[model samples]
Target: MAIAARALGPSPYGPPEGGLRNAADLIVRDAVAYAGRCDPRVSVSGEVVTGGISAVLIGESRRAFAVVLGDRGLGGFTGLLVGSVAVQVTAHARCPVLIARGTARENGPVVVGVDGSPHSDRAVAFAAEEAVLRKTDLRAVHAWTGPASTRAGDMLPLVYDPELVGEDESRLLSEATAGLTERHPDLLVAHRVVRGRAARTLIGQSHGAQLVVVGARGRGGFTGLLLGSVSQALLHHAECPVAVVRAAEV
Candidate 1:
């Protein structure tokens, strides 16, 4: 089903497009090639009205995976926009949403942010799969700090050297990366442990990344049309496109 886009609003999925051009076609093609056959694809084009939009979109694409062509204007007034259109689509869309700025490439590792939450494991699995597909490394990162982690650090070798913060994080990173290596024996996987917010650390470390993978929600399972704040923050802020994996429910 294709929508002429007579409108655009809180639709259930990404929009279908028409009147395509070479640049858009190439981008769509490259992203598809990078994502491969298992994933869905949708090309989104519309006249963004800075702070507002037409409030309705037609067509539901194959599986609602959208690549929105955003202009420079939306970046400035992003504050006025709640969580950003990209974020909204990534969070609410039925399937995964790939919001890209430039063409896709299979270079950087699929970096996933893990917080020891069940959702984090799902994200790690998602990242590992991406690494397998791209023939690249998987960087699974977990950041922990503050008082709650003190005793755990004392007992955990990775976090044992509290005074040696660098060493502490190294151990933690190793622990997280171990699972990835076992699952995808052919994959080259790595991990990092930092001391800060999950979203900020991932964004900072993945500056030149190919893709930043994350979970739609965590154990807390926060509310609203969007997922957790970290997922939302990453969608708006990450330098590279993001792949958010929501935990599969029984």
Candidate 2:
């Protein structure tokens, strides 16, 4: 994890960056001892946001979870840039991003977004493992726009289109749910399929959720809309924590 901080002024508000190195080292050391995990590496790198500490973990195993710690209390001047660094990193990073507030609780349930992306498949694999390790129930949520589509003022099966779109959405949710079940049979899994905008749907669902996971980038680039817009939105404003997963091996 890349944790970077600088001593802008002094103590009380944002503690000096001096102790962060030792603190991060201690945490990693203890993790290796108790968790028996071995990334055998850690870092405290610099970023745009001054004073606040940001952690970036690199070279961790495919199954290893990366915790991006964002310290609370940003100076008014840097508040605007707070999300800038976190957002860019969250959007681009290959691993799951954990934005930890000073008040974050440990050993919490992990919430990941599944929108049928290949990236989502990878996320499911990762989150399921974490849940098993933490001994927590895994909530795999699928958000569908029953009525929201490209055309704003149009309906299919015009004769009696009693939410034909809704039926399709239900199928989408069912497929996503069933797909995960087949892939992760041993996982203690529970799923939710809700109707709303994708981002809004998941963000709202994540209120009581400990961690929110989504794809880093989706298939919505050019020819094929592969990624979910909702996934992008969740990274912007998730109540608890957010993790962006990439479907492909990057």
Candidate 3:
């Protein structure tokens, strides 16, 4: 489905005869045409509505499998990689929100961040389905940092065994993706546990990835925060499309 939202306001000359509607129609028409070219067998529909674009899209997202949006919209500054509308919709959308950015490799694997959080679990599930649909492999990544690494200038150096930390993180990755192969018998799956920040690690992985999927909010996020740092970072800087999936109850 193609949707275009136009906000109409009072004008001294009154509404310009069919101007908003015509522009909206053209936008949706072009979108439908492009979709038709992408897959001739798929049925396409269009809708032109009058309201705030983000609100309209968010409302429609309730029934959508996913809400796909460009990283930046028409109103943003040229230098802004992610627009306000994209961020708002991504945060509030009921289903997965896929933000299209740099050109996605047609054959790259679907990469997902796995942190053993419920939100991360949902993201893994979403990525698994996407990988199966694309007939590509799924790569689940879990990134971690030493306890003291995140802190600035400490009085005492915190000591921990790197080997044990690595082992624990590897186990976490395994547990996070334990049943993926059983659920998707034909889907290929790979696991990676790296010692680094989640966002940076996932961004590096995205370089050759067709899609990067991450939970809207990770384990470290505040309850009131709709979008987490890792998800936001990918949305702004990933090399391909980024899909942010939110847990059903969260």
Instruction: Please write out the lDDT profile of model 2 over residues 99-140, one tens digit for every residue.
Output: 653222355567767765567667777777767666776887
State the lDDT of candidate 3 residue by residue for 1-250, as single tens digits. Answer: 9886545443447755446566678899999999999999999998888778899999999999999999877788988779999999999999999998986899999999998889999999999999999999999998988642322344533788888878878888898898988999999999998889889999999998999999998877467999989999999999999999999986
Determine which window of 10 residues in candidate 3 has minimal summed lDDT: 148-157
Tell me the TM-score of each prediction against the true structure: 0.60, 0.59, 0.89
Per-residue lDDT for 113-143 in model 1, tens only?
A: 8765555677777778878978887777877
For candidate 1, report its TM-score.
0.60
- TM-score of candidate 3 to 2 decimals: 0.89
Best by lDDT: 3
lDDT of 1 at 17: 50
- Scored by lDDT, model 3 comes in at 0.88
lDDT of each prediction vs. the true structure? 0.61, 0.57, 0.88
Note each model's CA RMSD in angstroms.
Answer: 9.5, 8.1, 5.2
The clash tally of candidate 3 reads 0
Off by over 4 Å in 2: 1-67, 71-81, 101-109, 146-164, 177-186, 221-229
Q: Candidate 2 or 3, higher TM-score? A: 3
**Model 2, TM vs. native:** 0.59
Local lDDT at 209 for model 1? 74
